[model samples]
Target: VDTFFGDTISMVVIMTCCVVGIIVNVFILVIGYLDWATRKKLPNCYMIVSCLSSSRLLLQGTVLYSTLCQGTHHWNVLRVQSALLVLSSTACLWFAACLSAFYCVKIATFTQRHFLLMKLRISGMVPYLLLGSMLVSLISSVPFIWTDFSVHLCNSTRSSVKNTTGDSTVGNISYFKVFILYLTWMTIPLLFFTASSTLLIASLWRHTKQMRRNMTGFKDLSTQVHSNAIKTLISFLVLYFCSFVAEILLGIPSCLAKSRWKHSICSFIVAVCPSIHSILLIFFNVRLKQTFKGILLSMRGRILSPFVLSFVLIIN
Candidate 1:
């Protein structure tokens, strides 16, 4: 009964993540598309964000399908599904890292020559950076395919009873390989994200100090932009840190301590991160926020219009 209850809770959490993630990512994509349709060209940051949203949508869909398959005992396709999940997740993370770096370069006031050069080139380099990230993600997913193949081959060669020890050995090796892959793929992006956010925060701090010294009683447009940028970066950093810790906990065998509940909670957290972060992005971005508000207002008006008309008619 306890096991059944745990499984039910896990399923509920996974489904919620999938549903919310799909909705949020779809909304992001719609906003991106509408922005592009109106302007005819998206800025580099928005372009990357669109890509991130698409990747996240794919990831969520895959997770949803994978979860359903697990319950239905249709495990045959999970190998490919796992590979796709890894690919999508990698793309999502790298795009987010690129977005952070872009914001840091564009918003931070730095006197360094390298910083200036980066600021100048970032817009033009975004496409190539995204392409490179895709290639890296593809490379990272290749090992998963190999692992799947190796496991299949091993299983084919021996009977289940005879291969118990060999299966255990292969499982251990697979886990180690996955752990290494996670570390390798995640480390550079995590470092880049941390560095960019730190630089932006430091720049904001220095600028605030300067404004105080100058006694600028009124905030300028530039100051407001810096303040907004700081808020956005800090919010993303917090979400990223939480998701990163959850991912690390899920990846490390020792960390789980054979606790199914811990594993389930971490899985749910990982699944929910993209959705939560995307919602935060919408709130922080001016255009997206306005667009969201317009949508809400329109929805409210539509829902209330008929009732309002009926009430007015009765009053008359």
Candidate 2:
């Protein structure tokens, strides 16, 4: 009964997260598209963010499908699922890292010639970088097509005639392959994200300190901009760390501990990260925030206007 109840709760949470993630990512894509349409050109940051949101949408969809179709033994299904998982996860992380790098390059002020060159070239480089990331994601996912994940199954009954040595060898090889794949797919992107975020934070911190030293009690526009940027980055860092830790935990076999509930809980947390972070992004971005606010106000007025008119009529 306890296990059943826990599983029920886990299912509810996971489904809710998956639904929310899909909705938020879709909204992000729509907003990005609308902005691009209006401006006649998409900025590098917006482009990267749209790609990230799209990848996250696919990732959440994959998670939802996997959860719903658990325990299926079809090779083709498993292969497709594994491939999609790798592709989406890699793309999501890579795009997020690219977004971080874009932010750092655009917002950070440096006197170095190389820094100036990077700032000047970043827009031109964005499309190529995105292409490279997609290629890398595809390459990383290709291995899943040929790899046999059956060795990881906890319940495999072997007859006495079965070749134990061969089985052990295959299992060892599979484990090694998965380890390398995880390292390549997860660790590298994480390092890139960390490095970019650190650089941005350091740059912001230095600028904030310099501003404090130069200015008095008066808060200037530059200081305000710096403060807002720092706050946004800090918020992103917090959410990124939470999502990263959750994903790492989900990937680690020992963390699951043979408990479906534990796995479901981790998956739920992972699914929530993308949606929550996207919402945070919308809130932090000035144009998106204002647009969202306007929509809400319009909606409220529409809903209340009828009631207000009816009340006025009654008074008359």
Model 2 error, position 96 (Å)? 1.1
lDDT (Cα, tens digit) per residue for candidate 1, span 43-74:
88789889888988988888787666653312
Per-candidate local distance difference test:
0.74, 0.75
On the 0 to 100 scale, the lDDT of residue 80 in model 1 is 70
Most accurate candidate by TM-score: 2
Query: RMSD in angstroms, candidate 1?
Result: 6.5
Question: TM-scores of all models?
Answer: 0.83, 0.84
Residue 161 in model 1: lDDT: 17
Worst 10 residues of 1 by lDDT: 152-161
Model 1: residue 221 alpha-carbon error in angstroms: 2.7
Total backbone collisions for each predicted model:
0, 0
